[model samples]
Target: MSPFNNHLEVAGFEKILLLKFSICVLFSVGVWVIYTQKARLSSIPNSKKALFFLLSFIILRILPFLIIYVILDFSARSDVRMFYDSALGALKLGFVYRDFETAYSPIFPYLTALPLLIWDSAKAIVLEMVLVEGIILWFTYKYYKNSLGNYYLLLYLMLPAPFVFSILGGQEDIWMWAFVLWTCFILRKNSNWLLAGLIMGLGLLTTKALLVLYLPALFIFAKKPWQFMLGLLIVGIPSLAFMYYHSELLFLSPIQQANDPRTPNIWSVLHPLTNGFVPIGPKILNWVGLVSIQALGIFFAIKSKKTSKPHYFLVFLFLIISVWLMIIQQSSLSNYAYVFLMPMVFFFGEQTNKKWLILLLLLNLFVVIQPPIWWGIGMPIFHSLSDLNSGYKVLEYITEIGVVVLLFAFLRIIIKNFKTTNNSNV
Candidate 1:
């Protein structure tokens, strides 16, 4: 069997039994490590302790996942496999567009292939991801206030959504988030529009969602727009030139992705009423959502002119992301919401108001927590709870609604922040 085939290994009673045994052993070790390290990590001076905890957590979690996944040869996501194939096509097959029906931006094929270059093993790719996540979380801790640094790190690692997505799903969203956070971190210290723009450009190649960051970049470099454009063009021009040779495949992902129907988004509720799984949507609403994204982007860009603080831009960014999640039909996966959690932890962790924090936690748990046999049994047990159901259709709609509620709550917090900031300025 091909290693990349997801259907064969992830199914069957034997595979489930093996996976369960591995998880049980790994969980026990993780608990033991935490218990033993608690005192030792606490004994370190506050200045140095966060890094200690961060690395310890990364290893304790990553080591088990690395071993189990390799032993089982668990399926990497189809998206990853597709990107791998696209990369191979690029490298050995002359990188033709229709060759693999490449749907992603030009740079992604190369980015995904970097791990394959290091080691032919799937574990190596996952390990590289774990390392990159470690760095992102470490800097997140570094930039956040010391008192809440450990809290944020623990929240990130222990969260169910992030955990499953990182280890099992092997989603590439973290790479995009890491680049955006790094860009913002640098901009926080100095006004380097060129570097920030370059980072944004690079990030876009990995995940189109990073296009949202352009709002903050525009505001930060409002006076130096030329520099921002120059930096963007530096990276973007080459990709465009490469795509020119690759032909129409450059536009395929964006076009098809916009209409692709996944679940657990606002569209889930509407899907039954609309065309069934045809990757189409209400044309008018589509236009509206697109306009709203741009309108909010422009608003944030204008509002950011008043304050030079990077937090102002971040606050605006939080709102823009919420709007994007709320409106974008393409964002059907619950994991897409992971983009908001990092910024939330950094800015809201220290806040006295726990409403948004609590809501976000509930949201993460609702989306991430899953029965062990979800894939093995072909569906979660909850679907059978309602006999009136059409194969878990009701449950899917409920999950999507829950996500919508959490998003609106978050939007309220954003509005409150803008009001408070305005009042303080006056």
Candidate 2:
């Protein structure tokens, strides 16, 4: 059975089943290898094991998906195509925002276009992403060697959210997370506020969602604010210059995006009450989300300033940003929230709550079963919600509700930690 679903029938269905089974086998064997090698996978000689784990993931996990992408050549998501185009456009003309239309920060075009200096194709974009992921994993292994075990590395790669989302979906959120993680590592390990702020400023230039982290991160750099501000200005000035030049196009994308109907977010719950004006509802919710996130960010930032465990504060800041990304953004997909996983592995280590991890993994499973939300298969089967049955509708609703619940859980943890800190002070 061909895995490419054209008619959505049993035609070539056997091939699809075989492919699925092969992927499962590969994953199981990969996990087995990690477990078998756990004894020797300690900190001193961790690189070889980390590299082995990365290769195994690429072969067992990513290779099959690469084959699938080849068979269904253009079935990949649009973000990569958009990135490729924006990058190419930036190279061909000028900057992406000044010339093309993208909501991404100004630096993304340059970053994406950097690859085009040697190669130019959607495949090249994915290849560049693979290299970026390899570099990120190497760094993660380096700073986090003491805490990160073979099992954590294996699971991080195999997890459906990070694996499929990064490889197949072609989302740049993974790259953003990698950058942010590296920044946090620098801040925590070296207490080098300047370098940390510089990396974070670059992160902000990659994705605006990083803004939610800036204030919270400030708490960690409070003693050396001047050096941090200097670092930010060094990398942030270029993007600011462009924004100053093209300030007119700045709000163009946001305005257009907000006018669309809400998706799996808090606004979606209020959308039904807004009549046909649901398209304009995010205009209000966007501001509300911003205020809410900032208020929480400031509170956590202050609380973090008083704590010795500053790294945990970074984790909470990441969680806050993830929640804002999940709920506040006018346009969001489930994969956007996986940025938390990078911090989760380092912070919780092997002692992390397995039940919650499993729950999050289960939520990501919904993406695999459901049709691609942002891809076009040249079939009319999944073009709209109307094309899907009431069952799919229910699934979508459940996914949204689950996100809200998760956001609330993180908020509760943040509040509890603050209260505990207050009592300890007294």
Worst lDDT run of 10 residues, candidate 1, spans: 379-388
Which 10-residue window of candidate 2 scores lowest in summed lDDT? Answer: 373-382
Q: What is the lDDT of residue 370 in candidate 1?
A: 24
For residues 1-426, could you state the per-residue lDDT of candidate 1 as single tens digits? 432233442345445435534543454344344434444533567867755675766565576576657776666652556656766766565554555556655566665667777776555556656666677777766666444455556655655556666676555666666766777676666868788778878876666644644444364435566777787889888877776766744445555565544445555544444434433345655565567666666676666666645534654565456546554654346666666666665554444244544565567654553222233335322322232144233434565567766766766666566545432111
Clashes of each: 0, 2
The runs of at least 3 residues in candidate 2 whose Cα sits more than 4 Å from the true structure, single-residue gaps closed, are 1-47, 60-62, 69-75, 145-148, 209-213, 216-221, 246-261, 269-280, 309-312, 328-330, 367-389, 407-426
Colliding pairs, model 2: 1-12, 1-15
Candidate 1 stretches with Cα past 4 Å from truth are: 1-47, 71-73, 90-93, 96-98, 209-221, 248-252, 270-280, 352-357, 369-388, 418-426
